[model samples]
Target chain A: MAQPLKFYFDFLNQSSRALYIFLEASKIPFEAIPISMLKGEHLTGEFRDKVNRFRKLPAITDHGYQLSENVAIFRHLAREKLVPEHWYPRRQLGRSRIDEYLAWQQTNMDVACTDYFQQKWLVPYLQKTRPAENAVNVAGKQLEHTLNDFEQLFLNSRKFMMGDNISFADLSAICEIDQPKSIGYNAFQNRNKLARWYEAVRDELGPYYKDVHGEFEAKLKQSGSSNQGVAQALKQ
Target chain B: MAQPLKFYFDFLNQSSRALYIFLEASKIPFEAIPISMLKGEHLTGEFRDKVNRFRKLPAITDHGYQLSENVAIFRHLAREKLVPEHWYPRRQLGRSRIDEYLAWQQTNMDVACTDYFQQKWLVPYLQKTRPAENAVNVAGKQLEHTLNDFEQLFLNSRKFMMGDNISFADLSAICEIDQPKSIGYNAFQNRNKLARWYEAVRDELGPYYKDVHGEFEAKLKQSGSSNQGVAQALKQ
Candidate 1:
């Protein structure tokens, strides 16, 4: 008679998609509650006061213990669930490496991807306006620099970020890249190593990646007029 | 004999001070190798290529396996070394709470403090110029907003972040706040809760806090003319 793990998320978010895939792939039993970020569902009323105090997407209540932040929720599940070792392998100090990347991503990759997504897509959709050319260009440049750093620092000749296996770092990074990628950003251009690694992660993730990413794409397309406006604006 | 743990750090950095205190308090045997960030020691030569490929401060090498990033090094120590259980307790899901704070700190608290520090102190020092009023004001506003968020979201009517005992979250956060504090930012202006929590953490840490913080202060003093210039510029 214990309360089930309740996951409240919006697929528009990169962390949300990554965690959704993680939950489904790991087969952790939980209630999936979709919160519409665009509608301000997470900001107003009950969800803010009672569910997540931070009022952020990609949150969960595990047996009444409310938790926010993507990395925190991921760690909580890894500790309290039957997560496969491959996701957070301890062999050869894999967990430490993942921890390092996650920390770095929080400061670097997450910032760049989220900023690009905002300028290219989210801010425009929210404001009912076209993407600001200058802002998008600035974000694009930053994203390019960050992707280069990501390749130089994390990715090498390995099939994935953590070698032959796909860890949460790969999952997290792929979803982060998709934030900009799905918004008409060319993340893989001129970065052959990153492109190959992306494919490898996608292939490894298979259906889970496809489904969540499909939902994300659908959500993007659902913002139909916004996308069209950006396309036309950029064209002009 | 096993190779003693090697810690490369500069006390001027917040995380470096935090980890240095942790090592001393925990009685962990480590070879403290100071890398001067002001001198660009972490950026060039052997430290960049051989020590940490990421070329960051507060790095560690345990049995020749190099690790970078503050939170990663903390977790690595917790897992591999005899860090006190109180630092990362398991009872009442303290670890999860700590993890949440750490993640939040990385994105929120750490960013605001570091940004404020850079704007108010580091940038001026590096460029041999007075602190830019506009940039410092912007960073000050951000730091103020972030401090407010920190109080509302994290601190409560408890002795510490996790109630009663000091965790790594408190340690990490206190150090982060000090970055701006050491540079003359008035962090405890309005938030009584944060002020109380800050005092509690400081009192709890006692001499260990004093020593590391003293070294940090000394580093600031050693910067000499940079501080004098900022003081004069702000007055004008």
Candidate 2:
């Protein structure tokens, strides 16, 4: 028997959750190796030297080849694995469209969302202190601008990003939004089109979205409670 | 015959120059429509409404379908046009590796280069003032860190990024580095491996690199002389 693909992930990371759901939904067999970002497992030791030189979460070692970067890994799976066509459809230049969105998300949406997540949760969690009011506000403002742009540019009177089918663009985007959303950011306020599209993608993915999102929420709650404890102690 | 793949680009933009070279080198027929980023042509009016809704440079319209983002356009060309196999070779999972590099570049290298360029040249050029000393220093420090990271993470003993053959990653990266290099930044300082890799890519590319780079240099000189004038006026 051939060796299964080795996936190193942490659900607290958005790309990790996105790819995890992708692997599960696609029914690709793989060994799940969870690496905690909180513990700095991905930053040093074996994970750094042996697995991924980039030291990023949600890396994969397929057979003997190592690959990092979420979008790259997603494309690799689409090409090398038995992924269905709908996720990265070839009909009517769908792949190009998806590619465009992915590129935009990498630069714009992902940056904004990740910055917001880092300021609001990750930094506070790591430092055992309250979120920096000014930094969080700045990140929030950027996130607001990005979400508005996302809705205006990508969202429309469609069930998903690429019309009817839920592509990886939608999957990746929802997970990105969740990074801010799970930490108490209201993304859907005054944005009905975005809300409808989000609901559609959520409905389409069903259990795959629910299970991974549940794990993410659980992790966030655990962190949140501990953070509150720290806040209380700081108050004293 | 097929509308010649209308490519809206500004040579001043790195991706534009990269894709222009790719289109030329690959012999894919494209109608080169230059939109000046300096004049804010890509930001408003028909270019924004009819061409690209995103208001970004290095955009394309192929057979009536629009596409944006350099990496996406490269992939689209590879898929839809008669691009050479070596540019995005499939053997030995070369495409995956290139994809990884491109993703990393979009987030890190491209960001640093653009920021540095903006601080060092574009911002001051547009505002008709000298470069902000503090901002330039910050951006320069970032560029230095990113250059080191790029050299360590991507460059190896290979003749190119994907070994022996010049891939799009090398092409794109060289153009990105030129964004800082053209504007008087010493990218080759103490980085022997990066310098060698750059020379190899430039040599392989031959005139495709030369013609575009010359035009870029010419534009830089024009803007640079005007910037000097502004400085001289301020001195008086």
Candidate 3:
């Protein structure tokens, strides 16, 4: 029998969540392995050599082939699995729209969310230091700007990013947007368009939704007190 | 009769340079339209509303279909043109490596190069102020670190980023590295492995290489103290 593909991720990461959900949705048999950023497991030389040299998450190794970068992972898997056109889009134009979303989000929502993540929660948890008021303010404003762009520039009133269809773009954006929830601020709270789109994404994801994101969120909640919380979660 | 695709780019942007070269190499018929960043052409209502909502490039329009982001543009073109498998591998693993290179560069060489571009040239050109010594030093160091990673982690003496045959990854990286040349620096000057690989990429691009890049290099040379030079080139 063929070896089950290995997925290495930490729930603290939005990209990892996106990939986790995508792999489960694709129905390809695989074992999901959580690498703890809290433990700095990803910083190990062995992980660098054997896994991703970039030492980033949402990466996979299948039958000895190692790959990293969430967008690449999504594209590779979508093409390889030959999933429905609605899922990833088969025609050149349709797929290009998905591509625009994936790439655009990098400097937009992803940057804002990560900055906000480090400021509002991760720094306090990991560094045991309070996030500076100025830093927090800056990050929050940046995130707001990004969220506005997400709704105005990309998500809009559409049920999905590529319209009516829940493609890889929808999965990727929702994962990034959900990052701000750690601060008890929901990006979808005021934006009806985005809120509706988020619900649609959750529905399309079905039962696989929680497994991909829930464990990570659970781990994040416990991470504040000690690194032990993350370590313990990894073991389970 | 079918309408030929429109390729929108500004040579000042490295990703645009990559797509310009790739489109030519793919043997697809296209009308290359240059958008002037210095003149704020990309910020205009018509460009933003019609071309790309994100208002970044290199974007494309085929008949009525519109798209933005170079990676998507390259992937879509490669698939639609049915280019040789070596240009864009048919198998998942082969394509994943290429994907890894393309995506890895985003956080790696791409970031560093863009920072360097802003510090060494763009800021100085647009702002009419000399780059801060401290800022330039920091940006240059970041670029050096990224180049080292590009060589050790990805390139490693391979004839191409995906090994041997050229792919979109090679085009993307070379275009980015070329940005430093506007400031009179060659990234490959000290790296033997990278220099050879760069030459191999240029060779593979064939006669099409100069047309995509040469015009941009020429434009950069004229943009220094005289916006008139750029205007003259545009008029031509």
**Candidate 3 lDDT by residue in tens digits, B139-201:** 889988888888888776567777667777777888888887556666766888888888888
Instruction: For candidate 3, write residues A121-200 as lDDT tens digits.
Output: 77766766665668878998998888887888776666777777788888888888778764556677678888888888
Report how far residue A116 has shifted in candidate 3, in Å: 0.6
Estimate, for each residue in B1-236, the C-alpha lDDT of model 1 and write its tens digit.
Answer: 55479999999899999999999999999898999998999999799777899989989988899899999999989988898999999898888889999998988888899988888778887877878889989988999999999999999999999999998899999999998887777789888999999999999999999999998887787785556765543343
Compared with the true structure, model 2 gives a TM-score of 0.96
Structural RMSD, model 2: 2.8
Deviating ranges (above 4 Å) for candidate 2? A229-236, B229-236
Error of 3 at A167 (Å): 1.8
Docking class of 2: high
Q: What is the lDDT, from 0 to 100, of the residue A58 in candidate 3? A: 71
The worst-scoring run of ten residues by lDDT in candidate 1 chain B lies at B227-236
Q: Across residues B89-151, which tens digit of lDDT does each residue of candidate 2 receive?
A: 999999999999999999899999999888878888888887888998999999999999999
- Residue lDDT tens for model 1, A1-236: 54479999999999999999999999998899999999999998799887999989989998889999899899899999999999999999999999999999999999999999888777877777888889999999999999999999999988998889999999999999988888677788889999999999999999999999998887777675556665553333
Task: Identify the candidate with maximal DockQ.
Answer: 2
**Native-to-model Cα distance after best TM-score fit, residue B154 in candidate 1, in Å:** 1.2
* Model 1 DockQ class: high
Question: Which sections of candidate 1 miss by over 4 Å?
Answer: A1-3, A231-236, B1-3, B225-227, B231-236
